[model samples]
Target: MKKILFLFVLGVFFFVPSLSVQAAEEFLYICGPCSRNFVPIAEDVIQELALEDNVHIKLVSCLGACTASPVVEFKGEIYGHMTKEKLFALLRSYFTL
Candidate 1:
């Protein structure tokens, strides 16, 4: 019984590290008001770049940048006046796309 318990503990230790080694996923937050225009664009970019598994798109009511209606928050940095061209450029630089 003691040997079986020791083996179980050993197995858990090896398994947990593998779970932590997975690549971190990135989150893109788009403003609700601007989602009408930006969601599709974001979806297209992710699909085109085959980043569906690594990137996630979320819609929020606001990022408190209404003047810059189409705002997006990534990696805790807020970007305003978002455009499809700019998004492509940003992602390309970060993701090596």
Candidate 2:
């Protein structure tokens, strides 16, 4: 009984911190229908950066900006009219890469 309790405590110590770390990572959201054509390019940039672990990418339906067709938001900042160069620059600035 004592051994089981010790093992449980050990497991919790390792598991809980990892969950928090994952939650703390940066979140990037791309407007799907609004962003239209730019979504795949942004995804490819994320892949190229190997930022799969460091950043969480979410595909949202719309950012409420129909005019800003290719919109992306990161850390509460809205970026619109994204080109591959612009996306790369943003990722570089965010990651300091």
Candidate 3:
């Protein structure tokens, strides 16, 4: 029993670090009054951003910044009142070469 317990603890010690090492990338959270309002444009942004590996872009509903529809938050930077043109351009500048 003691040997089993010791091995279990050792196994956990070896495993925990790898879990934290999983890479999480920054994304632009585009929040509109409805997901439909911006998802098509958002899909374009995602496709554009996806060209660069490890960048994740997703569209969400009501990020509580809806007073400014089409809000883009990247790495905690909040941009308000986004248009598809501005958003597509801004993301390219930020996420691409």
Candidate 4:
């Protein structure tokens, strides 16, 4: 019984922190149906910046900002009127490129 308890504690120590680290990873949400549809741009910039390990890009249907079509959400902040150049700038600033 003591051996089993020790193994369990060791497993928790080794695995729990990894789970929290994964949970803390950043997510970039792009509105797909928006007029600009910057998903491709976002993907390209993420790849170009080599931020695949640090950022996750997700294509969402709508961010409810039609007037601000082509919206992007990063770090819980929403940015509107996004273009290729703007996205590049944002990611560059984010990753300090």
Kindly give the number of clashing pairs for every candidate.
0, 0, 0, 0
Taking the tens digit of each residue's C-alpha lDDT, what string does model 2 give over 31-82?
A: 8787757767877888898887777778887787778768888889888877
Model 1 over residues 19-75: C-alpha lDDT tens digits? 785545899999887554789888898888788888899988778888885799888
TM-score of each: 0.71, 0.68, 0.53, 0.65
lDDT of each: 0.84, 0.81, 0.68, 0.79
Question: In model 3, how large is the Cα lDDT of residue 55?
Answer: 58
Best lDDT goes to which candidate? 1
The lDDT, on a scale of 0 to 1, for candidate 2 is 0.81
Q: In candidate 4, what are the lDDT values of residues 2-56, reduced to their tens digit?
A: 9999999999999998878342358888877874457677878878878878778
Worst 10 residues of 2 by lDDT: 18-27
Measured with C-alpha atoms, the lDDT of residue 43 in candidate 1 is 88
TM-score-based ranking = 1, 2, 4, 3
Error of 3 at 6 (Å): 42
**Stretches of model 1 off by over 4 angstroms after superposition:** 1-21
Estimate the TM-score for candidate 4.
Answer: 0.65
Which 10 successive residues of model 3 have the least lDDT summed?
Answer: 48-57
- Candidate 3 lDDT, 1-97, residue by residue in tens: 9999999999999998888854446666766454346667766766766643445567766676657766777777777777777877776776553
Greater-TM-score candidate between 2 and 3: 2
Deviation (Å) of 66 in candidate 1: 0.6
